[model samples]
Target chain A: MSLDQNDIAKLARLARIRIEPESVADLQQRLGDILNMVDTMQAVDTTGVDPMANPYDAFQRLRADEVTETDQREKFQAIAPSTEDGLYLVPKVID
Target chain B: MPSYTVAEILQKLESRECSSEEITQSYLDAIAKQDGTINSYITVTAEQALAQARAADELRAKGDAPALCGLPIAHKDIFCTDGIRTSCASKMLDNFIAPYNATVVEKLAAAGVVTLGKTNLDEFAMGSSNETSFYGPVRNPWDINCVPGGSSGGSAAAVAAGLAPIATGTDTGGSIRQPAALCGLTGLKPSYGRVSRYGMIAFASSLDQGGPIARTAEDAAIMMQAMAGFDLRDSTSMDVPVPDYRAALNNDIKGKKIGVPKEYFSAGLHPDIAAAVQTALAEYQKLGAELVEISLPHTELAVPCYYVIAPAEASTNLSRYDGVRYGYRCEDPQDLDDLYTRTREEGFGEEVKRRIMVGTYALSAGFYDAYYRKAQQIRRLIRNDFVEAFKQVDFIAGPTAPNPAFALGEKANDPVTMYLEDIYTISVNLAGLPAISLPAGFSNGKPVSLQLIGRDFDEAGLLAAAHQYQQISDWHRQIAPHAV
Candidate 1:
């Protein structure tokens, strides 16, 4: 159940969060502790118990396909880190 | 004015004994003087609050005012406030001003409640103690060195210190109730979907629920009347009819069956908290309520189950905070991966990053069934325990937390130890049942709370039971020493 540096690195990559090399050991230790605590659930036999995702077992409520929202592109884009032509600007992915 | 509870202030407002502007000014003055030491508020909207109070006074003069009109309340920064900074006590959103009001804020404002300001919270509502907040830890009003339990610590501390009459708080696990318990205030976590989550920053979408923190159950009821309802904007918002919470506050609990879960009185619990809960149970018995010793066999698994599920959900919800659309961004990103990774790493606090990592790992490909699905299956078992207990009793009673507020840095280094603070309260959230924490007694001069868990959507009954107890007890009336 313990996480090593490689596992921590992989998790950070998957989660898209960078962990400094110095903090990785500490993270591994703390995350290992948390996982150890979470491992307690393994002791209970949950055979055939239906997984409950939502508390009420309520399904997603469908709404009609309608354009209810007013255009607030300018208002919203005003707060973005970077934007151009009402589209959010991010690091270029295209080669 | 500082000594009055929300209910008392409401009477004064309705009777015109004092003007709304005066009450708002008094709270503003108090916050100005006391909040420096307590660190309760992240932002204080003094000008806007006074403007809203004056508008409320104008409405009152015209003989048309909403039920909670003119009341000043603080909002947990997690709830977005239009044109105001809603930080969630994190550096990520420290510069982000919300474009729209959260449904709770909008609804409360519509009901004539003036906004005092947004209060501090654990970063992304991630920690048990307020120490995780980027704004700094909210000191317990009772003792300046201790923490006001979080992530609703600021809301609880603000209300407990009389900086605000009532404040809104969201409970993903025990954020609302634990802080309320520690601060010696009444905090309610209504049934899941009972309140709209629209615009409220999502920590764990399934578990996150907004409720009221106040000095008494009556005040909480009044706040709940303005808060609980269905909103078309939120997909999970319930369609059930909202009840008159205040009307049922005085209902007699004769022959009511309150189940005392044996597992809740385990060895991990503090002796003082156990004694306080026992005394409160005896008081309930004297009020003609019968106590039944019940068992929630899966109680021990709740913490583990919640840790897995909440983090998994939080990891997904927080992914939206990439450097693109809004919120904090890194200085120079050479590539897309660098942008996301550096932004998140630098923006989020240690606890938030820890949870995101835990959640990502739990939902990762190979470990999905072992962690995520297994936890969900156990979540069903934990919920079933409450369902069965409710069948045998009208409500479940226990101590809100294992212990009272500890020193600020006591559990900061220990994550698991901090996680256990919500052991008793998390199960109710997992089960999506309504629960309330009432100030039961004091332990070593710190506050201890008695929690009452009710059936789904039964907030009226839960508040009534809490209100009945408050009628006979003076614990909730004991203001923190700093406030006094």
Candidate 2:
């Protein structure tokens, strides 16, 4: 149940967070300690227990398909990191 | 004037003894004089507050004022306020201003409550101590050298110090109650779906629910009455009619049965805190309430279960914070991957990153069952314990936290030790029940708290029990020396 430096690096990549090589050892140790605490969950027998997703077993409420909110693209896009010609700007993906 | 509770302010406002502007200005003045050492506020909306207060005065002049009009309150920075910075105490969102108000914010604003400002919290509401806030740790008003239990520490501390009479706080796992206990305030964490979560920054979709923190349960009830209601914007919000929390306050608890969990008095609990809780329970007996010893068999499993579930949801919710969207962007990104990686690396605090990594590993392929799924299964068992207990008793009583305020850096070096600060409070969130932390008494000059748990959506019961306790005790009215 322990995580090593490599495991933390892989997890960082999956989670899209960068890890400095120096900090990787620290994160590995901390993550390992956390997992060890979480490992105690194994002692309880959950053989027939159903997994609870939401505390309230209620389903997501549905509404009729309709436009509720007015167009606020201009207002929303105002906060984007980079916006030009009504589009969000990001680094080039294709060559 | 700053020391007056919300109920007192309301009476004053109604009688025209003081204008909302005067009250709002006094609170603003108090913040200017006191918040330097407290660090409770991330942003103080002085101009907006005065403007709102003037509007409330106008409404009163026209004889159209609402119940909460002109009252000042501090909102946890986690709830978005239109055109105001809602950082959730994370550097990633430090520069971002919300385009819309959270449902709670909108509801309270519409009721004419003036927004004093946004209070600090753990970055992304991830930590048990205020030390995780990017703005810096909030000092406990009771003792400046000690930590205010968080992620609602700022709100709790501000209310305790009389910087504001009432403040809004959200609890995922003891974020509200733990801080409330440490700061000697009444903090209620309502049932899931009891309050709309729309525009409130999500830490865990299933667990996060906003509530009120104030000096008395009556004040907390008044704020909750304004804050709770249905919203189509939040799919999980319940459509049930909101209860008259204030009216329910005076209900008698004669012969009511209260469950006292034997597990809560475990060896790890501080002796002084345990004694304070015992004294409070005995007082409930003096009020003619009966106490029955009960056991929540799976109580020890709550921390492990919550850590898995909350962080798992956080990793997914925070995914939208890539440099492409509004927030802190890494300077000079080489590519999209670098943009996200470096941006997140530089933006989030250490505790946040630690949680993201833990959550990612738990939800990752080949380990989901062992961690996330098993934790959910254990969550059901933890919930079942409450269901069984509630069948025999009207309420569950225990210490809100294992200890009172600790020195700021005392447990900073160890994450596990810090996590245990929420030990007694987390199970309520796990069970999705309403709970309130009552300022019971002092231990070594710092405040201790007793918690009362209610059935789902039964905030009225919790508030009534707390209000009854406060009616007979003066602990909740104690003020820190600096605040005086």
Candidate 3:
């Protein structure tokens, strides 16, 4: 029921959050407190209970596959960090 | 002017006793004088309000005005309002002006409701208290030092303080109802897909629902009429027909079977809250209703289940803000990864970051089955508990929170403690049931709210019970401290 500082750093990396190096200790302590609270669920016996993956189990009522939306790439990409030729420019994955 | 319902206001417009411009101006003046102390509205749309009021008046002249024409309403900052800064109470969207209107906002506008302004809330609707908001905390009108429960605190405060007649609020967990109770208002969260989520900013997709925070259940019903509908844009939007919510608000609950869940009255419940709830239950019994004792054995599992599922969904939903699209951008970045990380780190609040990390960890490769899948199973058990109890009772009753509003800084430091404050109310969201918190009574000087939860899409029955209670009691009529 403990969260190590290293685990906190790893979590931060995965979440893409910039946690200050000094706050790692605080984050560890806080995460420990939270995990301990969640541990309260262990008292409830959930044997043979079906998992509720979604509150809505029904199939999504989708419209027929159609281009209902007009292409707004030029307008939307105007605000992107980096874009060229209607594409977002992330770092070269193959490189 | 102080206690006019939406129906009554519409009547006044027909009689020409009041024009839409006059109604809108009076509300603007009231908001100006009252919102200074309450800090409810983050942005007030004065120009748009005046213009819209003028338009509603013109429509009325032609005798073609909508039922809600000229009615001033507060929109949560989370909804995208065209040409308006829909900040979502986060630094990320502070400078981001919404290019288009959210479907709900557009529908409300189409109904001729005047846009009063954008109300403040927790950053990205992440926390229970409005303290986590980047704009600043919205003060509780009852006790300035105590927190107005959130992330719908602003909307609740506005309605309670008479800043706006009614306001739109989105609840992921107890966001709307808990705050409504704390602020002494009637707020309802319809079934999971009752209200369209097309324009609503995503938190936990399954749990989050936008509904009304109003002075009375009748008002909430009127507002819900315009809000609840199917939208092709939102895939999760229900295909079921939205009933006449106002028509079901009959002040009759004879032979009603009310359930008092034993699990809700267990440890950690404040004595004052218990007394208030008992009194409300007593009132229901007097109205020819029978009180039935029910048990939701898996109640304890709700908090943990909600924490896991909500954050897991939130982690995925919130990933869209990567500094690649519209929102906050860092001044300089060494690489693409650096750009995404620093911008998000700077934009989101502490609580938001904590949830994203927790969600990411729970949903990660190695821990997915252990944490996410396990939590999902517990969620089903918790819901089954409700279904089992509903068979014996028409509705389940409980304190919205264990106690009245807490001091501003009390639960802010510990996120777990703050999350538990919503323990009693979170289960309804998890179960996708329509639940409403009525102004049951008061504890000491502060108000207490008793949450009435019903079967999925049973908002009519819930509102009927709430409206019936309000008819015999003046709790809903009680005004905010300063507003009075």
Candidate 4:
């Protein structure tokens, strides 16, 4: 269950968070300790147990397919970091 | 006047004894004078608050005052306040002003509660101590050198220091109650789905619930009456009819059976905290309530189980914060991947990043079954333990936290030790039950709280018990001297 620096780097990459080279060792140690603590879960037998996601055990209520919200694109985009003609701008994707 | 509870303030406002403008002004002034040392608020909308107060006065003149009319309160930064910066105390959203109000904010505003401003929290409500806040740690009002228990630290500290009469707080894993305990205030986390979560920035969606942190159980009840209800906007919002929480405060708890979890008083818990909690239990016995010893056999696994589930959900929820949209963005990115990674790395604090990493690793292709699925199974066991215990007793009681407020930097470097702060509180969230932390007594001069957990949607019972205890004790009334 121990995580090495390479595994830490893989996780950061998977998580989409950049890690500095110097901090990788520190992250490796902390993440490893946390994993070690959680490793105790393996000892518990969960045979025939259902995976409980919601605490209430209630089913997700569905709504009518009809549009319920008014157009608030302008209002929402007002807080965007960069936008053009109602489009959120990001780095170029297509070569 | 600054020391009045929400119930008292409401009466005064309705009788025209104190104008909303005057009350709001008093709170604004207190926050301005004392908040520098406490650092409880991330933003103070005094101009907006005063304007709202003036309107509330006008409404009062027309004899149409709402229950919360003119009562100024702080919202945890996680809940979006329209046109106001909702930082969640994270640099990632340091500059993000919310375009729409969270359902809780909208509900409170509709009830005529004035927004004092947004309060600080553990960055994205991640840490047990407020130390994880990107804005820096919030100091405990009781002992300035000690840490205020958090993710809802700012909200608790604000109310405890009289910055605001009451504040809205969310509890994923004891965020509200832990801070309330350490700061000597009352914090209640309603049953899951009891409060709408719409626009409240998601940390761990399933476990995160919005509630109130105030000076007393009655005040918490008053605020809860306004905050809880079904909302169409939030899919998980319960459709159950909202009860009159204020009326339920006086409901007699005589002959009620209270369960004392045997595992809660383990070796790790502080001796003083155990004694205070035991004394509080004895006081309940004096109130004609019977104490029943019960065992939640899976209690110790709550922390480990929660870490896996919360972080897994958090990892997915936070993925939406990629740099391109609203939020902190890295400059001069070579590509889209670099933009996201660098932005997050630069944007998130150490604890947040650590959680994201752990979550990502746990949910990876090969480890999903072992980590994520297994944790979910363990979650069921933890919840079942509560269900079984409740069959024999009406409520479960334990110390809100293992110890009183710890000194700043005491467990800052050790993540496991920090996670242990929520050991007793996490199970309630895991079970999606209602729980409250009341000011039982003090340990080492800092406040210790007694936590009570009830069945699903049973906040009424929890509040009533807390209210009865509060009537017989004055601990909830003791304000920090330095705050005054």
Model 4 misplaced stretches (Cα beyond 4 Å):
none
DockQ of each: 0.89, 0.86, 0.60, 0.84
What's the lDDT of the predicted structure labeled candidate 2?
0.92
lDDT per residue as tens, model 1, B1-484:
8879888998999999999999999999999999999999999999999999999999999999999889999999999999999899999999999999999998999999999999989999999889999999999999999999999999999998989989999999999999999999999999999999999999999899999999999999999999999999999999999989999998999899999989999999999999999999999999999999999999999999999999999999999989888899999899999999999999999999999999999999999999999999998998999888888899999999998999989999999999999999999889999999999999889999999999999999999999999989999999899993
Candidate 2 lDDT, tens digit per residue, B344-398? 9999999998888888888999999999999999999999999999999999999
True contacts kept of each: 0.90, 0.84, 0.64, 0.81
Locate the minimum summed-lDDT window of 10 residues in model 4 chain B.
B475-484
Q: Candidate 1 chain B: worst 10 consecutive residues by lDDT?
A: B475-484
Candidate 2, which segments miss by more than 4 Å at Cα? none
Clashing pairs in 2: none
Report interface Cα RMSD per prediction.
Answer: 0.8, 0.8, 2.1, 0.9
- Model number with the top lDDT: 1
TM-score of 1: 0.99
lDDT of 4 by residue, B1-484 (tens): 6678888888888878989889999998998898899999999999999999999999878888777888888999999988999999999999999988999999999899999999999999999889999888898989999888999999999888888899999999999999999999999999999999999999999999999999999999999989999998888998888888888889999999999999999999999999999999999999999999999999989999999999999999999989777999998988889999999999999999999888888899999999999999999999999989989999999999998999999999999999999999998999999999999988878999999999889999999999999999999999776564
Give the winner by DockQ: 1 or 3. Answer: 1
| Candidate 4 docking class | high
Q: Residue B258 of model 3: what lDDT? A: 85
lDDT of 3 by residue, B1-484 (tens): 7457676787888789999899888888988887888889899999889999999999989988887888888999999887788899998888777877888898888888999999989999988889999999998888888888999989888877778889999999999999999988899999988888987899999899999998889989999999988888888888888889888888468987888889999888999898889999999899888999988888888888888889899999999888877888887776778888898899898888888988998898898866788888888877888888888888888888887989999989989889988989999988888899989778767888989998888888888899989889999888768662
Candidate 4 Cα deviation (angstroms), residue A72: 1.6
Please report the candidate that would top DockQ against the real structure.
1
Q: Kindly report which residue pairs in candidate 4 clash with one another.
A: none
